[model samples]
Target chain A: MTLTWDMQDAKSTDDRDVVLEVKDLRVHYATPLGDVIACNGISFKVYEGETVGLVGESGCGKTTTAMGVLRLVQPPGRIVEGEVLLDGVDVLSLNEEELRRVRWNQISLIPQGAMNSLNPVMRVKDQIGDAIQTHESRAREAVKERILELLNLVGLPARVYNMYPHELSGGMKQRVCIAMAIALNPSLVIADEFTSALDVIVQRVVAQTMLDVKDRLGMSMILIGHDMGLQAQLVDRIAVMYAGNIVEIAPVEDIFEESLHPYTQLLIESIPSIKERKPLKVTEGLTHDLRNPPPGCIFQFRCPYVMEHCREVEPPLRELKPLHEVACHLFEEQDGKIVDISDESVV
Target chain B: MRGLTPGYLIRRLGMFVLTVWLGATLIFIIPRLAPSDPVAAMVSRLLAQSGSVEGSAEMIEAWRARFGLDAPPLIQYLRYMRNMLTFNLGYSLTSFPSEVEDMVVRALPWTLGVLSIATVVSFVLGNTVGALLAWRRTPGLVRTLLPLSFTFTAIPFFMLGILLIYIFAFGLDWFPVSGAYGRALTHNWNWEFVKSVIHHGTLPALSIVVTSMGFWGLGMRGMMITTDGEDYMILAQAKGLHPRRIFWLYGVRNALLPQFTALALNLGLIAGGSVLVEYIFAYPGMGYLLYQGIVNTDYTLIQGIVFIMIMGTALGVLMIDLLYPFIDPRITYETR
Candidate 1:
């Protein structure tokens, strides 16, 4: 089924609408022992020109959800039981022929480790030209011209066209990847942990460069990162995932200030802020295994305010306030009315 | 930084000369150090041909002087080095009528023709099929062929050669039993001669091809499997490149770096033809000549053949070093 986002909730001041909506996207990997559920019913939406960040610690299935959105997950890790609606076309259902047409033209990916993401043996121009060459038979001059334009767009020199990947620095190679990603002017770009491998300074530069490119091109994006601070600086909305489930999602401002999910609150507190220098709060338990997850709320084991019923029943993601959603039994109180945890009376 | 500089070229050329010189010295000295003197046999033969005591001493002196055996060992070695430096290897002791150069030139084509073609064909075909097998996406009989390829590689070349000879030569009678061409056809530039040459060369060529193709295929497959793990491979796929383009352009191109060196060294391996197999097939190649040179202790012939081997391998190494930069961008020729 096509994943649908209600128009009222999709309302934004910028007047853009949803370009990508992932609903109940469950990606599982089959191993010798058993099946590991990487992404269990994950869902999110990216509106036009919006940067939706999927923030989580490593192995929390953030990349898997992004791979699902692009239909690029390989064998043994299948995107099972999901709808990845890119511009209303279920990318999950597209055959090889149809997917070829959509991939890199309508949607592209700036893969993780862009430093080595390019073909090392090929020149930067040829590597970038591969995207154009695959979708359409463009002229050599046109390809060269497009590569130069893309290099210009990514702040790379035209001389990089003939250089191999080994000749470029880590940051330069990443820029080349950005150029290739937007070569076709795809409507959506997925940046999967793109800045995780860069230094703090280069990270900011590349992240801003990506934002500048996004602003100039007016494309939607799904940026996956573990750093909430990094996500806050760039994305409009943040979907904080835990153990293959989106525990909380709201505007970047609200995710930090008015986070209804305890996990999100803990995550925000756990960041060692330079302004405060407070001792970082560490979560007490290992993440639940996807192979055999608990029967009830996945976070109940580590959750501080776990109710008796939370151990037995799963809590669906419910909207506790305008544009703020949290999956927690704590929100299921006071006769279905939303409870403000910050208010002293609730404690 | 990676440009081919004059200094680097000069250094490599110097290295090539040093290697050839060392090889020539060892071959020249090792045979002299042997217990039995090859020159003594020729001297005794010369003495037997003379009538008797009358002018026998003069005849012995003439034979020794002709072969440079009358001089001190060190002087003889120096003279031999100078002769080899000028491309003169004297006459074969066993086949005294022919010069060492003449015999080697006559035997060159048989070894080069069959082995060179077999090696190149196997390299191309094996590497292509190997890249396909390790691509991991497409499936159909690749896994089945995997074990078989490894098994084929594990089998020794001579054993495989013997097996092919047994099956195709003896059992089916499909190809010639031995030799480079029909004895009836004289070596010429005509189609008939070429056709007969190929016809007789098929079995030996097949022996080399079957034994060697497996090694190249196995090597490339391993390299491809390693390359498949490289992030560029995923990047190529994400670029929406066709499976075929990615297989060749990204996968095989990178996978070829190691295999290319193997191919260059295979040039050396080409000249060192299968002595046992060539002997069994009675092919008139360097290997057969090498066998005869060793058995008869034809010092001049042995030294000549060994010199060719040393030159062939040294050239192969030099070619590999020169082409490495082109194959892999990481290899740069830096100035000292």
Candidate 2:
């Protein structure tokens, strides 16, 4: 049986269901020196059948944020405090049994490295079947048929059912992971750098498979990656993270067209183009130490329009426009127009 | 065989034969290089027993011809290889008229029974202990107590055997001091004899298992830790499979691959038994036979036992090589 959601029915932001809501989520990695703030009080929401791209540079806690939301952060990293409410259920407060039942059934993960994400010794069917079988028991024949169907859903051949993970190509392995994540049709799927290891051609194929599977299943997704171009093409909205904090988040077009945060501006400028050769725009500041962040806006040191007040007060994430939020002190909404309020000398 | 190509199987078996041949040739040459003649040594012993012997030179010459010592070294080497091919180890030097193979046959069962059981028990117990040691969910008391089990690994097995014999055999009188079975019982498959055999075999087997299990446990612990950190391990946890399933299937299954190769090599040593442990217990196994052969300088007996051990080891490696692809689908001999 096919489950379809009418795209036209829930067009309004108010009418759409919030499938996932991550609020004040903080994850820390323990060390002898101190705790490294990996995901520093990050918050976001994914509406029903919406894809929110969490894009950032390497080590900016995009994966950690997803892990924290899924309650899969490994030690010496732990979710210190916050709420990860999936479908209005408080995931952090659930007992072990309850948490397990929720995982992969309500929210599955297509991990960062698809090549290594699968158990090498197990066959493809078994790996896909494991996710399905863990939450519910079914007849062996039915499980086999369902696994074959899942392989087909991801555009993989039926022969892949009997093959081990190593037998499949990288793209095929990625599709297997995608199929596995959507096996139970979880409401939300977290794809963490899912296409990073693949070549450009394979990346496109795997990305297409993910989009196809996601559309057919109509699941909410948090696609965590660093590919600005890919994010622009695939996601409805984009969240730009820096130094363990989301510097800016908006509809993809708004993010690309009129980005508010300074870091987002630099990120857009850095996207390589094939048409012309331009000097690379390299922002000239290292990220502050994660264990001890500076007491202000995280991007203050790198922002071109840094002000005296920006160094002392941590800029809160504020909604300055419809469905657009930015964490910066440079601009303010005046009569529905974002006006540059920074000191002229600093600009 | 299912995973192995005919070419790979032939190559592997060929390698096994080459190993046995090399071992046999080395043993033959090394003993010859020592400059001690077995016949001369036997004659000297006889001379020491008697004040004078009539025509001892002539007797020596006749015996040398009879034993084929008169042949050139090259001829002797060829004959030795030919005999090895057919498993035709000659008569023991000290214990004349007894065929080396017959004695080995008599001792083989005891060694295989005791050591094989010990090897398997130690491997299983050690790996289980190791997996538990590395497992995050293991109970507090178990984690504390598991290291104590490895304490015996630090001591040599024979020394542990001595300690066991002193405590359980001598002090408590719970079992016999030495031998493979009770003196009163006849060798049979009946319960009383079997029980007695187990009783007698306990300390020797216990010494081996207790001492060697720590090595296995430590290796397994290291592998389990590495396997636990693999990317699939995190995905397995995220899959929300029960902790037990993850521990055994995802964790232990992958961790156990290297250990299987180790177990194969260890199984090769079974034909030799623990030379010292068997000596200490006076158990009638290959180790005890080897000890007697060394003491008496019975070249044929020593050669026969060593050859059996070499064959056993080569056979073990071959079996593992052929079977590896079946256990781990990733390993394929078809490529080789």
Candidate 3:
């Protein structure tokens, strides 16, 4: 019956346009003692023309996951195992030259710190021109026009074309990075906390510029950051990572309203609310060492609702509802609704 | 573009002039501070040579009068400053009738030709080796071998000169051991003179280059390492730029800024620092002239050489100051 259905599914649909697919991607940083698993076999797919927010607290492998996808992790950090499929091509399998050709042309990056992402000595035009010229050799005038077009697309003035990175303001620099990321009109762009270094007002402006550009260019993006507020404003789907593994991933509203995993629920509660006065939620336990994670769930040590089964068996990410996935042992699908099996009574 | 304003230029030039003035005054005061007078010292050497010359006291007085030493201290200072401005340095005490200006002019070309070549070669070679050593993508064998080239830096350049002379001159008989050119070649503007000069100056130049390149290499390696961690470098890689392009345009270009500043300082000190090397090789340059002046207590010659050195150094610093804004756009003088 499955084979017959597979034959009938030969034509691809528009909604299933998976621009980037990261499967079982494991990244590790080699230390003297052992490998510290930064991204532990995390998998996700980014559909075309949508933003996926990889959200977690600092050091929870959000940035590592982005770097792993770009193949830009520095020394001591190694992509131990994984396949980063950009437009159905395995990025990990490419040679250096081949990989270089694939980068920026198909997948560009708006780096973590926009303040230093640009070459200080280089002019804004040259830095943006580098991305475009590397992939396709265009006439000088054409390249210049395209660069100015990109700057305008990101809501920057034309005079910025001649200015060095030092001459620009922080928001302008972040916008410059955003402009460069879209210079080549890449299929997938990874923006790693692109606005984390800006003021709140500037952050909003830059975020709006990003959204406008992404909409105009019709590009898919992975926005990596810990700002839940920003994620809510920008991203379509949110992947909440904990201890190097994505614990829960779902549509934006559902994760905010009906998060399944205990870690996800705590994360939602931790979001600061201005309307009500409540005691701050302080998690009790510390995170386990990444180099030596326990034999059960990654969040077991910090999970407030930890149980006997959670301590002995590692839980796999399972789809408990349509488009919502959770990695916790307490929840089970029963009668078309997720129910707490451990409660021993119906709610 | 904004830094090369006329006011900034004038201020920079004013600073250069101040440096030269202070340096000139110090050199003048320092020589006079010594207990022995140049005339008296000359007389004593003559007396020792001829076993008590007749009327030595009269001769000393007559010589002092001829050399304008009979003037008061203030008069002497005014005269000295006047002569310095006019480029009319007095006759050497030991080599009378041979003006200090002529001696310097004759020696200047040889020193500039060889030393400049050596300095530029060492800087380029050292920086390249250093950059490659720190670069992550450089081949291991190349990195390993590059460090061995800079080992000569541990040895004094004169010592290296002697070693080169011993191996290449005495042992192999491939090159001349001493002097700026072969005895057979006349000093003229011709290919033979240039070739013979190069052939003879090889050992001295090689000694300086090989010994000093390691300093530049070590400095460049440190800078390259620091530049490697810059956010731009990672972003450049992420942009899919060619590795060679990133290494040169981003990595080496930024690392080379401090090295250029150091180069200017090294260039300023070149004339003074080559003394030992020149002494060992008997190369007739400013350093050799300096050695002669020191040994003979030729006050005029020494003063001339020191003034020229001060001028060269101040000029070098001024040039670098003006060129800095072009090199690093962030260093604009327009704000001030």
Alpha-carbon shift of residue A245 in model 2 (angstroms)? 1.0
Candidate 3 lDDT score at position A17: 85
Residue B36 lDDT, candidate 3, scale 0-100: 85
Ranking by TM-score: 3, 2, 1
TM agreement with the true structure for every prediction = 0.93, 0.96, 0.97
The lowest-lDDT stretch of 10 consecutive residues in candidate 3 chain A is: A1-10
The interface root-mean-square deviations, each candidate in sequence, come to: 1.2, 0.7, 0.7
Off by over 4 Å in 2: A1-13, A343-347
Put down candidate 1 lDDT per residue, B75-124, tens digits, no spaces: 99889889988889789888888998988888877899888898888898
Worst 10 residues of 1 chain A by lDDT: A1-10
lDDT digits (tens) for residues A1-347 of candidate 2: 00001211233345689999888899999999999999998887899999999998999999999989889888899999999989999999999999999999999999998888899899988888888888989998999999999999999999999999988999999999898998898999999989999999999998988888877888899999999999997899999999899888889999999998989999999999999999999998888999999998888778788889999998888777777888888887777678788642222
Residue B187 lDDT (model 3): 69
Candidate 1 backbone collisions, by pair: none
lDDT of 3 at B198: 89
Per-residue lDDT tens digits of candidate 2, residues B278-320?
9999999999999999999988899999999999999899888
lDDT (Cα, tens digit) per residue for candidate 3, span A1-347: 13222322343223568899888889999999999999998888898988899998889999999999999988899999989999999999999999999999999999888998888888998989878888899999999999999889999999999999999999999999999998888999999999999999999999999888877888999999888999998999999999899998888998888888888888888988999988889888988999999998989888888999898998887766666778898898888688888884432
Q: Over all chains combined, what TM-score does candidate 3 have?
A: 0.97
Full candidate order by lDDT, most accurate first: 2, 3, 1
* Docking verdict class for candidate 3: high
User: Per-residue lDDT of A1-347 in model 1, one digit per residue for the tens?
Assistant: 12123532644333567798788899999998788999999877788888888988888899888888888777789977989888999988988778878889989999898877888778888888888988988899999998999999999888998998888988888988999999999989999988888999999888889988988998988899988788888898899898899988888998877787888888888887787778868778887777989988998878877778889998777655556678887763455456644352441
State the displacement of the C-alpha of residue B78, model 1, in Å, after optimal TM-score superposition. Answer: 2.4
What TM-score should be assigned to candidate 2? 0.96
